[model samples]
Target: MSKRDYYEVLGVSRTASDEELKKAYRRCAMKHHPDRNAGDATSEAAFKECKEAYEVLSDASKRRMYDQHGHAAFEHGMGGGAGGGAGYADMGDIFGDMFGNIFGGGGRGPRRGADIGYVMELSLEEAVRGVEKQIEIPTLDECDSCDGSGSADGKLETCGTCNGRGQVRFQRGIFSMQQGCPHCGGRGQTIENPCGKCHGQGRVEDTKSLQVKIPAGVDNGDRIRLTGEGEAGPAGSPPGDLYVEVRVREHEIFQREGDDLHCEVPIRLTQAALGAAIRVPTLGGEVELKIPAETQAGKVFRLRDKGVQSVRSRRPGDLYCRVVMETPVNLTSEQRELLQQLEATFTGEDARRHSPRSSTFMDGVKGFWDRMTSS
Candidate 1:
């Protein structure tokens, strides 16, 4: 009988992507595998058909040829065979690509260690000016007893299960796949005398103190990386990196936003009206700020180059000072009489000149009430 279409055999669309094709092939191969359904010739044939279909569809050049000329592209030696693609006949690689992790496929090299993170909280002044801090971290380090060889005697023997190949082959119907040896854990060897210090892990858990220098202008959530400072790898493999995360603590005087700083400065009512020079605190130091005459409460003053210098651009930002006018609380009889006489000068029309904002607000309220009454 004529061969079935590759896409039809895999139950995938003609325009299926490589990932979709692999998934469809995996499903079909698993469902119709003869090992799963022994003594069933129909299922065995279906498995072969799906296997051939996958071999052709998974290859780029063969897939293109099949798309253009169909099965005739491979028939009568138009091509080598259905399994003619590069390493298509390698069942170990094919099945390992599909189910290697689940079945414990063996790997050649030593695995890298896991990374770690540490959070460092700094004050606003420290973050802006840069500071060096010492930190203690609990992590895995290479054991000194066995020199990371995992064997106390520094000797290892070949695995009996896989015979030093690290992988064991198993027959599934007519085909077979290779899996990692369970006896040696895919290391191809076994320790004769395990290390007493690390207990054959090659690394031990220990607390390490490290001095970290924090850069200036590093904001909260910024991370600094230290190479090879994380957990040590198994069997003397490479170590991972350590990440130091920055967190700025809340300040009593100033609030930071990016490179700029903001602070509220309280001034007396007389200072706001009459204008005066006062000392304002900045990241650098205290600076003289002149309050303009007739300045209102909540007015903002900008001091150039008085904020934080950015770590990235190294440019300083402006400091913003919000003024808050303070009202007098306590007064003596003579002081109260002097204030009453001063207030008496600004009455009726003079009140509009002295307190224009209050007069305009009162006028708006009166207009609103009159409109409401008329309506």
Candidate 2:
């Protein structure tokens, strides 16, 4: 019988991108994996078929050949049998490409430690002015007992399974494939006696306290990276980086937008009407804000260079203070009498001139009454 089309097996079009092909193959493989299916031969066969299809379709040169001349293009030196069979070298390349990310691949060299993130919560004031803080980070560090050798005797021996090749070949029908050795876990070396401390892992969990200097004007969600501060790699590889993400707590008095600071300042009705000088709090210090006569509620006052400084530019931002006029309450008899007299005097003036909004609303009410009585 003729072999099925590679795209048909993976359920992808020939024109699919490498990412799309990989996604389709991953979905199918995860669904039909032998471990997931557990003794289902049909699912295992389907999983292998999908893997083979992805191995060919994911590669540019192989895909081009298969598209141009079908499976016959690999019959000569490409190591395919009469009806499309892949060799051990091809399978090794596929496995390397797939598991390389998981195993950390830099040309089959030493693996680096995994990068980690540490979240640091800061108050609004701390974020604006910056502060030095000490953080405890739990990470994997090199074991000091066995000197990170992962062996009881601080010595390593060649793997007996793959014989230092790191991979083992297996024949499947007419195709041959190579997979990472389970014995050595692709390290190509074996520890005869595991390290008593780290159990041959070469790294141990430890909490390290590090002092971090937060830069001025770092906003919420900003990240600072410290190189070589993350977990140590196995044996002698380079350590990964540690990312410090900043989270600014909400402030009760101020709200930050970009580099600008916004705050609501409540002033008495007398202060809004007759005008008064008030002290407003800023990041730098307290500043006097002059409220002009007839200052209405919701009036915004700008204080230049009183906001947070920019992390990149180092220049300061402005602070905006919005005035909220508060109504006076708990008036004594004398105060009530004085307010009543003032209200009478103001009412004596032309209604349009004294209170335009009140005059307009009264006229509308009168018009509505007239219409209702007439109807």
Candidate 3:
């Protein structure tokens, strides 16, 4: 059987970032983990599929090659020697080490903290114009008391239980297995005197105030990355990054589609009959738009360089204005009489010339009725 698409296996888009890919992989691995679904071959196969997809997509070179060549890049020696092999001999141990945190297992290593995401809501104006915003994020930071050492004296000793290995061996019937040390929690070390502030965790939960600079022309779903602004790592390890996602609120007057902006402008019936110049709202300011004489309703006018400027290209887009003629309402008796007298002028054959679209539509309807009766 053929392998599934890597992105499909991980349930992510091709444009997914490293953080998104990691999150998706974690979700899949957690759901399909072998230990979670014991004796289920389907679940085991699914877990392996996710793992293989993650391994290829997580690597920069491998991902690029795969993108260019598809699955062929990883087969027939294209992925290079030994890469094509499905090495699942020690899958259990490998997965246990990778996802120990989720399963309450432990391992010894300088693990980077998990990345975080924040949604930033913006008005249409704010999205068009660059703005700096202050935001608060709650996460774990290095404990000040022990300076992230986890010890009151800033010293740690090798764990006697795991013998500095961070794992202990135990016999289960016919097989022997290695598991994290219960005493050390897989750190392979022990804090003789835990820090009073953070116990032995080496981190403290706190809310951090940060200023994020948003660029102009950012659309919904655009992300801005802030390096090292995520949760602090354990034992002074490297911290992760923060992703600020943008969501633009719906505008009352205008609707945005890509770089273009569209709006409906209501024009008076007199203005539609006689050419007139009217003011319309644009992102920058109000601009004059001229309507030609006898302009029909729903006529679209394009105003160049009146829309949003693209963030990537720095090129301004056009604004499309669709005109709808508004009928006169609440007229005085004298005004109504004058309008009625004016309407009498086009009562005969002149009405066809005055209302050509209505005349053509009526003609089509008559033709349809004649054909239906004849048939």
TM-scores for the candidates: 0.68, 0.66, 0.67
TM-score of 1: 0.68
Top candidate on TM-score is: 1
2 versus 3: better lDDT goes to: 3
* Runs with alpha carbons beyond 4 Å of true place in candidate 3: 1-108, 159-188
lDDT of 2 by residue, 89-206 (tens): 5764656566544332223323576677899999999998889999999888888888777888978998776667655554434445344443454567889898877767677778
lDDT of 2: 0.76
**Candidate 3 per-residue C-alpha lDDT over 1-375 given as tens digits, one digit per residue, 9 for 90 to 100:** 988999999999999999899889878977986657878899989987897797678755457657977776545222212222234325445555664454333534445666889999999999999899999998879888999878999889997766676655432233233444445545778889988776566877779899999999999999999999988876676788999999999999999988899999999877998889999999988999999999999999999998899999999989999999898899999989988988889887889999999999999999999999999
Clashes of 2: 0
Candidate structures ordered by TM-score, highest first: 1, 3, 2
Query: lDDT for each of the candidates?
Result: 0.79, 0.76, 0.79
Q: Residue 61 error for model 3, in Å?
A: 21
Where model 1 places Cα greater than 4 Å from the true spot, the runs are: 1-89, 93-108, 159-188
